[model samples]
Target chain A: MSILKIDGVSKRYANHTALDNVSFSIPAGCIFGLLGPNGAGKTSLIRIITQITGADEGEIYFRGERLKPDHIKEMGYLPEERGLYKKMKVGEQLLYLAQLKGLSKAEATARIKTWIDRFEIREWLGKNIEDLSKGMQQKVQFIATVLHEPSLIILDEPFSGFDPINANLIKDEILRLRDNGATIIFSTHRMESVEELCDHISLINRSKKVLDGPVREIKDAYKTDTFQIIGNGHLMITSPDFEVLEQHENHGVFRANVRILNQAKPNDLLRYLIDRVEVHSFVELVPSINDIFIRKVKETHHA
Target chain B: MRKIWLIIQREYLTRVRKKSFIIMTLLTPLLLAAFMILPGLLMTMSGDEETVMVLDESGLFEGKLEDKKDLKFVPIAGSLEQAKTLYQETDYTALLYIPKISIEDPKGITVYGKKNTSLQTQMRLENALEKEIENQRFMASGLDRETLDKIEANVKLNTINLSSEGEKDNNAMITSAAGVVAAIIIYFFIFLYGVQIMRGVIEEKTNRIVEVIISSVKPFQLMMGKIIGIAAVGLTQFLLWIVLSFVAVTAVSAAFGIDAAPTPMEQLEAGRVAAEGKSVDVINEEKGEATQAEADEFANTIQDVTQSFANLPLLLILGCFLFYFLGGYLLYGSLFGAIGAAVDNETDTQQFMMPITIPLVISFIMSYSVVLKNPDGPVAFWMSIIPFTSPIVMMVRVPFGVPAWELLLSMALLVLGFIFTTWLAARIYRVGILMYGKKINYKELSKWLFYRV
Candidate 1:
């Protein structure tokens, strides 16, 4: 069953539409990728889901119930804009924020200690946030966001300011959170992360959702009947129905890229190509999620 | 309630632990003592004397003025023009030219000192001339000079105020002490706690901690905790200061001959007695004897003067101070909290703080109004009962007695005023905490107050 739902949500800022007829849902436990370019309304939808901002139209349900003010108690939101009290001590700030999310002092302390030990930040607990580097502060904030074990965790650009190792650590933690039955809404521009971790994906463009589905299903739906043939020859596109888009010679082998006509299958195209060129290799190109995302966004732009 | 207590605890602990707070608490008493006693110490150290050359031209009042210890009067044998010129050449400090005066009208006599002598010197010269004229009149009237001199004596008055219980004490000293205590208490607490609110707000806002804090706790709780915690801190500091002041005064007094230390009233009485004793000794040494009637007259004058002071009503003064200090702090501390919440930056606070501060200043300036009118009169009654003016007006009424009911009513009203203002301030704080960027004005503030919970 869906744990969180956004039904026909639309938001507008004066004359500009920020989110247009957006509808989506997250099932019980999965890493959901919210992918978009700049100004793509990803942040807007994330804000709506987290309840930081209200949607101009539509309703959000948490745990199959209408979302209310108190529902935020179960939602942990780490906004893109870094917010932490720079003058406060590391451990004190984390515990305070945890308590605000409804954790008892002893519970907050235990959770904070576990996270601090995991992140190797125990030495920095007594130090002021200002004394730490930006990455260290981000780590503290991330720990604060997740310390209460909220049911729905929304992390916006969580890996923005980290080195590769720390980024991987956070990535591992995100997966760990999802594995432990928490619904995660991860928003980012990093398509590679989407390829590795996302079970479901949503792509929004110009204040509208252009594409969304399970990562595998969306990739399959956009797959074209094109062939990647690595061989010695390129077939001439003599038929009006078929065409060769481009050709390149790679290390004593000719690689041809082509798109077939409608009603034609990849097997048929391969049968035709085998007779003309040395069939060193023939493979159908299944579009990666990134390619599908770019193509669909560009298609929407043109439409 | 628990969260508010936590907030209060943190604010109190953090502030009290600061070095600045400790330093300020200790430094204030030292500064106050310096202001009170520095002038007297400087005067004693200087101990300078003035020399005067008296030129009497008419020869009618010769050898009239006596040379005193601090002022040395010399009778010069020279004309007025010569004496004035001779002073420019010689180091004669000041030349006083007293023309021979008609015994019928003493106003005809003139006094001249080169380059404007001091007021003290001028008064001394004028007094000497008057005495000389009187002596001349006494002799011409066929009065026995020795007998009249024997009879003349300075009388000092002593006062005793008998309460309903028949307890006698000096009222003037009590009133002065009460007024000073009240003014100092109100001034110190208002300043100390008011700035704590400012610093507390700035710390939260500057560190961006207020965002998280306000999300869970109501702005009212946060602001209330801070104001109360800081007030508690101020009260603690006040108690400590009183203890320190007493210890310091005692230590210094002991170091400089404790035997010489007398209660303030006793010191005043000793001053009167010493003056009388010195005058009598001087007269007895000069005239060879003084009769019985002269001493009795001197004693009567001293008794009467002391009696006026001792009869003053002091209980009223002490009560007035207690009412005013608590009232004034509540009225001002609420404003200070409001100011704290209205602005995001410290620089922006200045614009919003003026209206609240001006009334406090006006109340202090018009404090004397309470003293001049009836202490329980309509004007003093209204000003003291009103929250804004009570702190200062109540102190001014302490010197004059006030009715019990009026005092109790004013105290109750001021307490109610603080509660209402604090509630209003909490409203502003709630909206102001989340509001960033735009400058807040009366219109915006009113809208914030009217916003739905």
Candidate 2:
């Protein structure tokens, strides 16, 4: 079942339409990717879902009910441009944010304590956020995002500033939260992370959703039946069954990317490559989300 | 409501816990008391005694100039030239060189000093010479000194206002002074707390913490929480200042043996007894002992002041003061908050600030010049009723006794104005806080105000 169903939400600013007939649904207990480039109405839509703003022309359903202020208690949002009160102590800031999300003081404190210990940041409890490093502050930001154990947590570029290790740490926590029956809407244009983490995504471009599906399904749909073949022999044969998209020759060997057209399959392409060049390794080249994003955005831009 | 309370708690505690707030709260009253007491003490304290060497070149008079408490005179036995030549050798403050001139045409009467003598010394010398000449003239005309003295008359005009309270004694000078002072205080507090709200908004926006906050609470709640929180801070400071200032003034005035207000409570009782014997004041003004009459007049002034204070509708005035103070701040505070939200930083707020500041300054000036001049005038009537100017202008009229209907109308409009401005500001604020790096002007701000956020 979908935890959030956004139906034809449209938002207009003073001069421009921010979201135009945008519709998407976030499946329950899944990491949903809200993928869009800068000024692509992602923030605008997120703001609507968070109830920071209202849609000009649409209805939003949270858990099959119309979205209302009370639903904000189940929702937690960490904006891309997020920060904490610099002069406020880390522990107090966490408790304040948790309470703001409708947790009682005692509940928030206990949850904050667990998170602080889990993150091994007990020493930072009484210290002001300004005294912490950027990574530490981001961790605190993440902790604040889920302190109330919100059902639908929205993280915008949650790993933007973290090092690889910290990013993995947060990525693991995100997966763990999903494992524990919490839905997370991860908004980012960083397609590699979307590939690494997002199960489902809706691509918004120019205030319109140009793409939507599960990551694997979208990748499969955008598949060009391309295959990368690396071989020791360099003589390539051109045939109607297969086309060598590109080939680069090295010392006594050639690496080629080929696409099969017509009714040909990857097995056929592998057999064809085995006849033309001594095929050492044959692998199907699945479209990366990056290439799909760029191509999709470019197609819309040109249109 | 709970969310707003949390926001308010955060805003208030963060500010109240600041070192600057603590220091300012503790120090402002003492500093104000010091400013009040310092100049008076400086002026009243006597300076070193200085004896002047007199060179009567005109020979019209000698030893006629009387000595004051801090000034003395010595008749030097020498020509004016000799005295001037011997000036450096004498331990005198100045040389009063009265050159030979006609008594009828007295000019070039100079007092020369190493450093020029004080104005008091010069005035004393002029009085002495004028008296000596006047006495001479009186002697020549065969007029008695007593009759001349009796010929000088003094008049005091007393104003009595017929109000609903019946025959309330109104001192125009004192009442207007009090009114203007209260107006100034209202103006001061509104700006002080209004800027605090603005800065607080700017801080949250610049820190990029506003979005995080508003996600959990409505923008209106956040705005009001901040505005109300800072108001509480201002009220806390203001109340502390009043109490501390009263204590400081009383202690310092007592230490210096000066009567700050002369126990209005005690004198209120004394005033009733003194009222039965009003003839003595008139008799003294006519021909009683100069010192006795002066003392009596001084005592009457103190009693008159306390009496005026007693007659004033202080409870009503103070209640209105609080209403106007909070109303004015809220009305302007929302605008200040909007301005803060519209800009990326404080430096970019000049254009937006003009609207709020201009009205505030205009009302303050009007209260001082227009409202104080004629509290019941048409200009005062309109200004007192208008929400933008009412807080200050009405305060100026309050002491001069505003009509109850006008007071109610002004207060009602102010509350409505506060509501309207807050609504307008919230619209602008909800959009502006999320906007960054945009070079915003009034056109941009108006656009923000209409955004359906």
Q: Specify the highest-TM-score model's number.
A: 2
State each model's CA lDDT, in order.
Answer: 0.71, 0.85
Please provide TM-scores, in order, for all candidate models, with all chains considered together: 0.66, 0.84
| Model 1 residue A201 CA deviation in Å | 5.8
Please name the candidate that would achieve the greatest DockQ relative to the true structure.
2
What is model 2's DockQ versus the real complex? 0.66
The C-alpha stretches of model 1 lying farther than 4 A from their native spots are A2-26, A32-75, A95-107, A160-165, A186-303, B30-192, B255-342, B368-424
Local accuracy of candidate 1 as per-residue lDDT tens digits, B276-367: 65444432232222333444354344444455445554455555555566567766776687777777778888777787767666665555
lDDT of 2 by residue, B184-276 (tens): 988998888888888888888988888888889999999999999988888888888988887887788789864334334435644654566
TM-score of chain A of 1: 0.87
Model 1 Cα shift for residue A281 (angstroms):
9.8
Separate DockQ for every predicted complex: 0.21, 0.66
Q: Count the backbone clashes (under 3 Å) in each candidate.
A: 17, 1
